[model samples]
Target chain A: MKYSILASTLLLAGGVAVLSGCSQVQEPAGICNMSAIAAQRQLAAAPSRVQGGESPLLEMPLNSVSITDYSVINKLYVRTVNARRTPTGTVEVYAQIINCTDFPLNAEARTQFYDAGQAPSEPISAWKRFNLPARTSNTYQTQSIGTQSAAFYMVELRETK
Target chain B: MRRARALPLLVLASAFSLSACQTVQNTAGTPTQYLDPGSSGVVRGVGIEGQDIRSMSDEMMRDLLTVPALANASISPNVIVDAEYFQNESSSRINKNIITDRLRVDLNRASRGRMQFVGRQYADMVQSERNLNQAGVVSGGTIARTAGQLAGDYRLGGRITSIDARDPRSGMIERTHQITFEMVNLQNGQIIWSNYYDLRKAAQDDIIYR
Candidate 1:
């Protein structure tokens, strides 16, 4: 009888110990919080204003010479070309224009070639304007304007005000 | 005598086992923390903290520019916005009406618009209209029409949403919240512009205790 009781008690104690050990082992792992970083990102992504007044030109009326329904003649284009004689052979020029506000633009704006002193040189009427409707956009080829001339050249909007 | 002694021993063992079970149950249960009203700089969760009308409005105003659609368009003249619909989500503790008020202020500032509050007289008008409809005295559609007549060109409407979840294995908690604002052209029922802002926060469960 004593041996039987001893054996049963030993078995119960061993089972209890095993269960307790398992429970301890199953305890949840620690967690690392990342809430702060998320909050920071949100704050950074938020749109914010830098201090400045509105542009003055936005309030002014757009100048128009004629009310003829015009299309956008040409969109802006820029390119570089090589000068034959000069060591600094490369020159760059940008050209573009809106054809008409009303009709679709047909011809691309031409690069009216000019000399160093703003005089007409090569009439590369080779540039053609394209049709662009009102409130629309168009693109044209970039021309190398002052490649060979040793004199400096500049491009400007030519339509008379 | 031997049998009697073994019975007492078995009872004691059973008692020990029962106590151990109770301890495990108590330890495994979830624990919660409450906000201390007196605590300072304890950043409240999205909707728990009292609404900061001024700050919220300012933030909303600034975000208006970030909308890609508006970037290239000509800037609009500032207009005034009155509160349309501002309420807290069901789960939030914050007062939703206060949020709406703040939004009005914020949008006004951001868009350079003004805000005009509907006074007590208008409130009475709305209440009377509600009562009339409830009593079957007037058509429900008339209420909106009457309100619009009193109000102006645009109506601002918005909603807020939020989610909170905790991961048991990682002991990580994440909270996400968003607000969407829309401007409706009342006459045409067209949505002229809409903006949305989302905020997310995550912290380890342990840090929550800290």
Candidate 2:
């Protein structure tokens, strides 16, 4: 009788161990370490389906204006994003972001320019910090230093870290 | 039952004794790693940093490209960019060459055939080489040599100034750095192009900028 009781206890412990491991398996590695490019590709593949709330989506073609931090999806919104060729023959990227929250927000953004072949045409831009007043909008703009005729750009936004 | 109760006491006593023992990790010292100079890394300070140098240079280069007087001149204008005229009036201990060199190099690369950069910093080396060739000690290679060194149409001049403040009670340090860049016409002493970058930073932990 005692041996049976001990076996039952051991069985219960084993079951608890297996259940704990299964619960942990659901939490995959964090997306924070992933590169902006890879994150954009992954997000483009399987977009969110939540109703009434819009997740941070690529605003422009070739995945421009990506919010790197997932926490800021609801806190910030990209109102407009555009790219154009300057008179000097270089490309310039501009994005207007809206603050969704009542509190002031500070975010850092950087840009990477690519050529027609989808290769880096110029060095990545330094992180530029912009402040957004509560419920207001702010614009972030950067110009490419490349003399290349055709260029594409990706701008990444994240909370000041 | 008694032994089991005593076991907990013994383990607690042993743990207390062992807590005083110092231990060393098995791994080697911190490994050298590379970080992007264009982005903020672990070490940061209130003064100007690598990212500032990169961004200011890049901005200047792009803005200069838009100016027709320089980038769209009838003939490629020879510009001299050196640390001779770039002054660091700020208290920060930084090598001025780091900023001017980057600006000159980036401008030269992106300018394509629109502009020219004269190496005023290396005039002595060029002069020595020319002397050797002229003295018949060395042969002048393929391309025909020019008469003399080219004169610069515009020379880059800039100043880095700062306003520093410290809160006596809170021990907070605030610094505002204003970097001004300009291109001057050598003959008429006219400021053809000018731009300035301003940044203000506050921090509590004192970081010595070397």
Best by lDDT: 2
lDDT, residue A113, model 1:
44
lDDT of 1 by residue, A5-56 (tens): 9999999999999989888853232221235422322111211233454333
Q: What is the lDDT of residue A129 in candidate 2?
A: 74
lDDT of 2 by residue, A40-74 (tens): 54344223357665657634445368887887766
Off by over 4 Å in 2: A1-60, B1-26
Each candidate: RMSD to true structure?
30.5, 17.0
DockQ for every model comes to 0.01, 0.26
Candidate 2 lDDT at A100 equals: 70
